[model samples]
Target: MAGVAAIGAADLVAGFGLAGALVLPAEDPESVLAAWRSLPPDTAVIVLSDAAAEVLRAEPAVRAPDAPLTVVLP
Candidate 1:
């Protein structure tokens, strides 16, 4: 449990970089999942844009009980 990471469209997630979060800009559902799969070891929080959240809404891995806290922005 440590820093924050964000994955989503460039415009939506760009601000996260200002806070020193690991920003991974993804274009599609697959890319979002790929980013999720490769999170840094120190990431304790993951922030996803609404579009990304919708893409992963049915993904079991994203909703895994043991995964880090995930926040989806509107």
Candidate 2:
């Protein structure tokens, strides 16, 4: 997990093919959104936060059919 966060580090192993960034206090939706936008066009945005997923669902960024958005609800 090179760029993975520390909190939810173990949750994304299967999705990322390795450990993923852990969700920390400093890494809120805004920060995660920025990172999501920075990813390549083909990159996927997998949301592990149920609340965050609901919020993102209302955003235009997540409306497209193939917008590379995934919501993993708890």
Question: Against the true structure, what is every candidate's RMSD?
Answer: 1.3, 6.1
Most accurate candidate by TM-score: 1
Residue-wise lDDT of candidate 2 within 1-74, one digit each (tens)?
Answer: 12332212234323443445334321356754554455555455554455445445567876777776465645
RMSD of 1: 1.3
In the range 21-54, model 1's lDDT, one tens digit per residue, is 9999999989998998899777789999998889
Give lDDT for model 1: 0.90
Query: Which segments of model 1 are wrong by more than 4 Å?
Result: none
Cα error, candidate 1, residue 62 (Å): 1.7
Give lDDT per model, in order: 0.90, 0.47
Error of 1 at 47 (Å): 1.0
